[model samples]
Target: MEYVTLGKTGLKISRMGFGGIPIQRIDADGTKKLMKMLVEKGLNYIDTARGYTVSESFIGEGIEGMRDRFVLATKSMSRTKEAMAKDIDISLENLRTDYIDLYQVHNPNMEQLLTVIGEGGALEALKEAKEAGKIGHIGITVHSLEVFEKALEMDWVETIMFPYNIVERQGEELIHKCSEKNIGFIDMKPLAGGAIEDGRLALRFVCANPDVTVVIPGMYDVSEIEKNMEAVEDVSELTAEELEAMEKVRKQLGTNFCRRCNYCQPCTVGINISGCFLFQGYLDRYGLEDWAKDRYGAMAVKAGACVECGACETRCPYNLPIRQMLKKCAEEFGA
Candidate 1:
């Protein structure tokens, strides 16, 4: 695997970092085996978040005796100082680590950003914890390109995690800004949450960007991991023809790409909004129809949960009519 210094943090990370979300679905033993395999293959940067249920715990359990062998990065969404301290402690216990290599604010919305970084907030708490050696670096993960550029202007942010894929190039300008500022750019949703079926092509597209320091793709199976490793090994510069082909695919996919931006969230009826959009895309883009159907069937609220509330639409960065989309989803996939 190719290694690059993660900008100002000075930590060298594998170009293909292991995103820890998918592992939450696997059994403990399965996760352990996959973790071992990934480590053996030279993938040392593992990224997880408290929001990804059981993901941090699984990584901790999987890497029991090999804790020092890799760099561990995890995030918390807590905005208050007290909650931030508690979440950090909880994360440390879950990850079986005394200190984290990188700790991030997990996709804070604009309001939360102001509150957290404002006087006597979570950002101050994080800074204090860093001084205490709890985390090696302070980073932020955001979904909006605007927030990303704003983050680049901050002195405290050393790394950024955001969505960047072949289809959604909205983050392109922000990626260039990060590179120019010497901030590490971590590409999340590099495959557009499996909306792009040809994993090799999607992975290659992101890696082709020289500004990207690491690309984290969530893999659930060993075959997926092996394929990703192979793709990284044989990584080639994107040819003009290939770029045009991908652009064609992007046009065909259109607004079908789920950046997992979480812009349309907190449904009035309490639906896990992003999950619904993601599983639907799985059926449409990756042909995982049965899997998508099963997952949709399992939602407690399902798509019908959207109460025609205008809240999500107002909040959506893409201006997606979330209520109407949810209605469509319910008609097509709700149990």
Candidate 2:
């Protein structure tokens, strides 16, 4: 496995870090086995979030005695000082760790930063947490270049996590900016949340970018982990033709791409909007038609819950027409 220095943290992370999101769907035993396999394969960095249901707990369970074998990071969405402090405690307990390698503010918008750092708020709490030795490094995760550039200006932040995929090149400039600032750049949605069919090509495309320190792709199965790990062995440099092919795929898919940014959340109707789009992408991209159909059928709201209220579109940074796309998904894949 190829290891790269995670920015100014001075820690080397595997280029293929284990993303903790998919572990929420696996049982305790399964998670334990999968994690052990990953660690055995020399994958060292693990990233999880409090928002991903039982993800942190599962990771904690999986890596209990083997904590020192890997670099662990998690995030919290809490904006207030009190909430941020509380969430940090909860994450610590869930992860069963005394000190996190890195802790991040999850998906902070401009307004959130203003509220959290502008006036004696969560930033102070983060500093206190670091001083208390609860977290080794402070970082932020965001979807837009605007917020990422803002984060680069702050000397306190040592790392950054954001979306960067073959389909979405919006973060290229920000990735370079992070590299210049020595900020650890963790690429989320490296496969565009399963939107890209050719996983090898997609993984290689992101790894080819020198600015990205790590690419955290969610893997539930051992085979999937191995497939991703294999990409590291022979890093395929994308030629001009390959780049054009990726662009063509992106154009053909258009608004169907789900960056998994989770901006259009809380669905008012309680739909797993990201999952719906994700499974659909799996069918279109990977030819897992039956599995995708079954998964979509199992969703509470399926695709029909999109009320066409335009709320999701307005909130989406990518400007996806979620309602219309969901309707199409329902027609094509919903049972």
Candidate 3:
């Protein structure tokens, strides 16, 4: 229940904000229930994105009458002024609020970032929206270290969202820079996309970082919310046992594992890149051979279907050799 002012924006939000991606798996009513519980527990920050497939709408429906109780934030992938302007309106309507506390430019690579800040770019629309009182602050979400570094220098950026977990500490230095620059540093993928089995350990590792203004772990149910809240609210220093557990997690996950951000999608051949990696990890690392095989079998497009177009690798923030990895998966699964 600890609260902090989001850098630059001065938005006072709970250290543990609600990530809205998982709500896509549930209905609007389910989201509404979670929203009610969030209010009761005093967890008031909610992060969603227009690309998260119904996430914004569900949140809008969930927070219907209780809009003022939350600091709402969302992002869009639109790189153009027209598209961003349109997305801002859509987000406002979907979130059931005319004024969004924060609107962000979704993950854009170096080229797209330049285009977005250039003439007729999304930044124009975001600034216009701020002037129009549609949004309170502007920010950017990035995956690669290059973009993270570049975003740090942008005067328009009030906040930055990046993946920071026990295994994904590559942004540690830049995250510190965020605090130095007075730009809110929002931590995403605090659980390393569910790679770290211990939720409490994952949360503790993130909450311990003073540079992180907020950590949004996607929640869909009451038990998860309560459990995550307990982990976040415990401000005590990390116990020796917890530190040992975190190291163990880093060792097991290594640096090559997937975080399942789903930035690599629409596989030229329609392969579920992240899903394939998920099942493969379970098959290879967790000894869930049968379960993994079953899930891999169910996929409409298997890893063997990858034609090596390399389109996905270009989008991957980690620059994962997805095609080669898929080849390994295909060999292991015998697809």
**TM-score leader:** 3
Give me the candidate number with maximum lDDT: 3
TM-score of every model?
Answer: 0.88, 0.89, 0.97
**Model 3 per-residue lDDT at 175:** 100
Candidates ranked, most accurate by lDDT first: 3, 2, 1
Summarize candidate 1's per-residue lDDT along 169-199 as a digit string, tens digits. 8889889989998999999988887767788
Give Cα distance to truth, residue 331, candidate 3, Å: 1.8
Give candidate 1 misplaced runs (Cα > 4 Å).
259-306, 311-319, 330-335
Arranged by TM-score with the best first, the candidates are: 3, 2, 1
Model 1, global lDDT: 0.85
Off by over 4 Å in 3: none
Candidate 2 residue runs with Cα over 4 Å from true position: 239-245, 260-263, 270-272, 275-305, 314-317, 327-335
Comparison by TM-score, 2 against 3, better one: 3
Clashing pairs in 3: none
Where's the lowest-lDDT run of ten residues in candidate 1? 256-265
Cα RMSD to the true fold for all candidates: 2.9, 2.7, 1.2
- Cα error of candidate 1 at position 287, Å: 7.6
